[model samples]
Each structure stands twice: as structure tokens, then as C-alpha cells.
Target: MTELNDQALLRYSRHILLPEIDIEGQTRLLNARALIVGAGGLGSPVALYLASAGVGTLTVVDDDVVELTNLQRQIAHDSASLGHGKAESAARRMRAMNPDIRVVPLAERLEGARLAELVAAHDLVLDCSDNFATRHAVNRAAVVARVPLVSGAAVRFSGQLAVFDPRVETSPCYHCLFPEEGEATDGPCATFGVLSPLVGVIGSLQAVEAVKLLAGIGPSLGRLTLYDALSGDIRQMRVPRDPGCPVCGERR
Candidate 1:
């Protein structure tokens, strides 16, 4: 971990004050690198909090441009950013919030070996993409690279959050919980309207998990959390590693 200057020390004083995250943890945070997938609804809050928390380097990947419809839930982009790339829009906001950190904005969608290579370079990854294809691809990459993954998804009135650390022997991969073809579904926000705040709730949790992982404190949520906005209720389900699963099964 690099040394924190007077300004950095003051900037992250709040995090430093915590018993669980003193100067040592704050230093770790200041030196950590995080990769965030997607820059729309879920990516907005995740990028915001991680940047504000002083994560040293952030790589944001997305291929979509900011449309007027995205303004409703994606807080990172505003009216001025309409038609701009989501990755670039979010990266600008992250730099604006904290110039101390470095933010890389990639306007291309990553897949195959490119995706896995990117995952290997980061200390942690946040999967905030909207589609199952991106999410599953991220899971496979994380599993192969042995990187920790913080995943979140929100649709309509429902939200889900989970922390999957591939370095852990017993933790389950995203593919383990939702098999490739069997559990996949097409529920984009365009098809079924999503409540705006639901994404914030889940995305914020993704930031929490990322910080905990980087700081080396707090209990990792090995279980999946289900949030129902309309019912105002939450449920936790255990995610056991599947020996028969393809992604992490071979590792076991």
C-alpha cells in the first residue's frame, strides 16, 4: 500500500476512524483496484460509492450510450450526457467526485479471452450488467482468475445481491445458482418497467461488499439476498457450491 498524504488522510478520515478499518485498511483501500461491468442503473451507485470511498483505480466497461430513458435510474449520467457513452459518462462523474483516484472508461463490450484478461488485472470485480449473458461470462472469468465478485440485479419491483469469492473453496459461483440456459430469462427494464429506487438499494449493497472485500473486514455475504420492493420484505437464501456445476465444480 502506498503512503497517504495529508489530504488523502483527511479525505478518508471517516474510514480510518473505524476500528475495523484503521490506517492500515484505509491504505489498502487507497491502493486497491476495482473493475465495474456495465454503467447503467446498478453501475451508477456502485461506481459512485467506490470512487467516493477512494478506491485507487477503477475500470468501467459498457457499450451503451446514455438515452433519455436511462436518466430515470442511472444517476451517473444526466441530461447533459445524453447520447454520450455510459462508460465515459460514469467515468467522468467518478473523476469529478474524487480526482485522487484513476478512472478508466471502456466503451467496448468485453467477451471471451479479453474479458478474462481484464478480470485478472483487478483486485475485485462488480457485476452490474443487465443481461444474464454478461453476468454469466463475468462469473466464469472470476472463477478462472480466482477474483472476488460482487453481483447485483434489479428488475421491476425485485432486486438480488450476492458476494461470490472464487478464492474460497465452498462459495458458489453465479452459474451455480442460475444455470446457463435453465434459469435464464429475458426481463429487461424496457420489457417490464423497473422501480428506480430498487436498483439503488441493490447497487449500494454491491459497493458495500466491494469495500468489505478490499478492506479485509466485515463478513462476506456467502448467501443471496432477495428484496421485494412492493412487499417491503427481504429474504436470504444459502448458495451452496454445486459439485456438478461446470464453472466452479472442476475446481472442487
Candidate 2:
């Protein structure tokens, strides 16, 4: 592990002071590579926090452009970013927050071999996309690369978060929890009228899980966290790997 410089030590003093993190864990974060598969609501906090925490390299992917409606929840972009690509916009904010880290912005929709290659290159992947197709695609790539994945979603007043570490023998992949064949009606926040800050709540948790996984801390694997913004309730449930799962199952 590379030794933290004087400036780095000062910038990350709070994390370095934590016994769970300390200098060693902070160093791990400095050397970590994270891939965030969205640049909207959830992706905003995930990218910003990971950058501020000193993740060495961050790759943010999104093909959409910032629109007037996104300003309410996508904190990474501002009015000046209107019409700009979401990935590039988010990258600019992340870079402004932490110039010590490297941010790569891919302004394109990822899938198939390209997606698999990207996931293989990263130490961790965060699924912040709104669609079921993207979630399943990212999960498949993470499973193939044996990379840990932090998945989060928010719509209306409901939000959910989960950590799937393919590195863990007993940890469940996203496919095991939400099979692709059973995908329900899904749409963007514009369709469901999501409450502002709901995505922030879930995305921040995703960032926490990503940092823990990168720093070798105990991550919330094999469980799903649910947040009900309406009732202000949080709950968690254990999720088990499926032996017949097509993505990460014994059959495969």
C-alpha cells in the first residue's frame, strides 16, 4: 500500500482517525477503483461521496443529458449543466470536490462485452440505473468478473439498497434476489414522482457499502435494505443465493 502523503493525511484525517478505517483503510480507499452505472439521482451522491472519500479512480456512466426535471434530485448537475451529458456533468463536480482522484466519464449506454470488460477492470461496481435491464446487465457483469456490486433504487417514496459480493462464497447476486424473468413495471422518477432526497438516502448508503468493500471492512452482503421515505421506516432482510440462478448459480 502506498503511504499517505502529508496533504492526504490532513484531507482524510477524519477517516484516518477511525479505528475501523485508520491510515491503512484510508490507503485502500485511495487505491480503489469504482464504477458507477448512472449519473442521475442515485449516481450523484455515490459519485460525490466516493470521490470525496478518495477512491483513486471513478468511472461514471450515463447516456442521458441533464434536463430541467433532474435538478430536483440530481445534485451533481446544476442549471449550467442543462443539456450537457450526465456522465460528464457528474465527473466535473466530482473532480471539483476531490482533485486528488481520477474521474472517467463515459457518456454512453453500456452493455454486452463492453460492460463486462469495464466491470472486470474495476474493484467494485455500483448500480444506480433506474431500469431493470441495466441492473440485470450490471449484475451479470459483476458476477462474471467476481467484483463486488452495490445496488440501489428509489422511486416515489420507496427506496432499496443491496450489496452483492461475488467474492463471497455465500453472498447472493442481484439476480438471486430479483430474477430477470420476474421483472415488474419499472420507469424513471418522472413517471412515479419520486420525493427529493429519497435517492440521496439510498445512494449515500450505496457509497458506504462501496467504501467498506473497498477498504476490506465488513460489507452488508447477503441482505437487502429497504427504506420507506413516507413512513420513515428502515428494514433489512436476508437474501440467499440461488442454486439455479442463471447468472451466478451452480448450474452455470
Candidate 3:
């Protein structure tokens, strides 16, 4: 895209005013494409803000339907969309919010080879899925494609954010922190329960990091940033690359 037009400069006045994200940065954001792996809690705010911020292309992938329980946090879908495919519902909302961007909905579970194919096409991927299995798959595809991956997870009152850019020689990956899949946990939002706004917090951060990564505005959360909503505390720690990790390690 060329330099922001006068209308665009007026539309994104706040963003353009920011020294970190001037007119040039907004143009970069307009040319980038991002793939979001899930359209649930974390995806809701992530998709919403990214669309509003002018991410040119956003592909939302999800196989689930909007259930009544999702109303607690998944803001992208409403009562009218109950039982509808989440990808479609979320895409509708995003497009309604910002008609300028292109939003694609993939109403199918991304698994096996499909995940790799979809991930390979996007400039970056966001892991908003709530399970280790999907997270691992997204991470593997990102590493294989050498695209930046912005991952965020939130449950109860806790949240985590990280960026795994295998393209960067020193960056660590998702598996580097949680080496093994471990026994599955019954901590889904329906089970253990999650704070409604907590997901928004983490997801919004993920969107900001994604935009920054695309616009070259600031440093990404290359390591891990942890948050405890209950205590209002935050911490950041470096994640070391694992030489033997299955995903991004020696297998490549």
C-alpha cells in the first residue's frame, strides 16, 4: 500500500499520531496478513482490535459453533449467532466493525496437513486455541513456515503471552517452555471457569504485539509475559531455546 491517504490518516488519527506508529507503520499494518487459529475468548478481542486497527487480511479458523455458554467471554458472537459456526460468526462481527479489512472465515478444524497449508499462507499466526494439541500444531506450522507466531492463553485469573519466531536464530518456541504435552487438563472455560475480561486483556495484548511485529514498531514478546488478574501482578522471563525440542529443535 502507498502512503496513507488523507481519509486514512484521518481515520487512524490516533494511531498515526503515535510516534511509534506513524503513517508508514499504519501502511505496513495494512499490507500484512494474520491467521488466528481459534475464534474463542482470546480470539474475540484479538480479532476485534486487529480489524479495527486495520490489519489488511485476517483469516479466522474454528470448527466450533457458538454455544450459550460462550457469551460469557466470546464477544464476537451474539445470541443471534447461537449454534452458528464460530469462524463465520466472528468474521461477520469483524467485518461489521471494520469493512475496510478483508476477513475470511474457515469453518473447519485445522489439523494434520490443513493446518500447515493455512499457516504457510499468512504473514503471521496467532495461537488463541485453548488446548495444548492445537497450540502445538500451530507452533509446528509456524516454525516450519518460518513465520512469527503470537501465542496467548488465559484461564481463571491467569494469562500468558509469547512470540515464537523461529526465523530469528535466538528465539525460543512454545515447546521450549512446555516441553511435553503432559496429561490433558480439565481447565476449559466451561470447567475451571475464567474471568470474562481476563481473556480480553491477554487477547488485546496479543493483537498489539502482532501489529507491532508487522509494523516494525516495537519489540515483540519473544519470551513469555505472565499475568495474574487476581493479584494484578505481571512478570516477564526469557524462554531459552531447546536444542532437542520436537517442534523447533534439531528436526528442522
Candidate 4:
């Protein structure tokens, strides 16, 4: 582990002070590499919190560009970033927040071999995408790479969070919880109006799980957390791994 400099110690003093995440855990965070898929609503908070928490390297991927409509929930981009690539815009904000870390922005849609290679390179993957296709693709890559994935989604006042660690024998992968064959029609914020803070709630949870995993702390694996903004209720449902799952099962 790389030794923390005086400035880094001062910058992350609060985290280092915690018994759960003392100097050792903070050092782990400083050496961690995180991959964030999408830089929109959910990705914004995930990226910001990870960066501020001193995650050493962050690779943010997104092909979309910032538009006026995104300003409502995408906090990483501002008026000045209008018409710019979402990944780049979010990277800029992350960099601005913590120059001590490295931020890589990929302004392209990741798919196939390229996606798998990127997922293999990272210690952790955070799925903040809106569409089912992208989520499934990312989950497949993470499972194959044996990387822990922090998945989150928010739309129309509903939010969901889950952590899938392929390293754990009993932990369920995203495919085990929501099979690709049973995919629902994607309902993005653009279609059904989303509460602006809903993404923040779920995305923040993603960051928390990511940090815990990177710090060698126990994560909330094999369970799904659901947040209903309308009724103000939060709940968790245990998700079991399918022996017949195509993505992470023995059958595969």
C-alpha cells in the first residue's frame, strides 16, 4: 500500500478517524480503482462521492452529452457543460473536487469485448445506467471478471440498490435477481418524470457499498434494497443465486 502523504492524511482525516475505516482502510481507498458506467443522474452522486472519498482512479463511461433536460437530476453537469459529453463533464467535476485522484472519461458506448476488458481492469464496477440493455451488459462483464458490482436505478419516485460480489460463493449476481429474459420495458426519467432526489438516494448508497468493498469491509451482498420515495418506505429483499442462472450459474 502506498503511504499517505501529510496532505492526504489531512484531506481524509474524517474517514481515517473512523475505527471501521482507519488509516489502513483509507489507504485502500487511495489505491482503489473504480469503474462507473453512465454519468447521468445516479452516476453523478456515485462519481462525486467516490472521488471525494479519495478513490485513487475512476473511469467514467458514457456516450451521451449534456442537454438542458439533464440539468434537473444530473448534478455533475452545469450550464457551462451544456452540449458536452456526460462522461467528460462528470470527470471534470470529480477532478475539480479531488485533484489527488485520477479520473478517466470515456465518451463512448461500451459493448462486447471492450466492455469486458474495462471491467476486468477495475477493482469495482458501479452500474448507474438507466436502460436494461446496458445494465445487463455491465453485469455480465462484472460477473465474468469476478469484480464486485454496485448496481443502482431510480425512476418515477422508485429507487433500487444492490451489490453483487462474484468472489462470494453465495452472493447473487445481477442476472440472478433480474433475469435478462424477463427484462421489462425501460422506463427512463425522460419518459416517466422522476423525482430529482431519487437518484441521489440510490447513488449515494452505491458509493457507500463501493467504498466498503474497496476497504475490505463487509458489503450488503445477496440482498436488494428498495426505496419508495412516494410512501417514504425502505425495504430489503434477500436474493438467492440461481444454480441455473446463465450468467453466473454452474450451467453457464
Model 4 gets an lDDT of 0.94
lDDT of 4 by residue, 1-252 (tens): 687999999999999989999999999999999999999999999999999999999999999999999999999999999999999999999999999999999999999999999999999999999989999999999989999999999999899999999989998898888888884666788898899999989999999999999988999989999999999999999999998898999623
Query: Pairs clashing in candidate 4?
Result: none
TM-score of 3: 0.94
| Clash number for candidate 4 | 0
Question: CA shift at 128, candidate 3, in angstroms?
Answer: 0.5
In candidate 1, what are the lDDT values of residues 154-245, reduced to their tens digit? 99999999999888888999988899979568467988999999999999999998998998985465699999999999999998888888
In Å, residue 63's CA in model 4 sits off its true spot by: 0.8
- The lDDT for every candidate, in the order shown, is 0.92, 0.93, 0.88, 0.94
Worst-scoring 10-residue span by lDDT in model 4? 179-188
Each prediction's TM-score versus the true structure:
0.98, 0.98, 0.94, 0.98
Model 2 misplacement above 4 A = none
Candidate 2 lDDT tens digits, 1-252: 566899999999999889999999999999989999999999999999999999999999999999999999999999999999999999999999999899999998999999999999999999999989999999999999999999999999999999998878898899899988884657888888899899999999999999999988999889899999999999999998997888998624
Model 2 quality (TM-score): 0.98
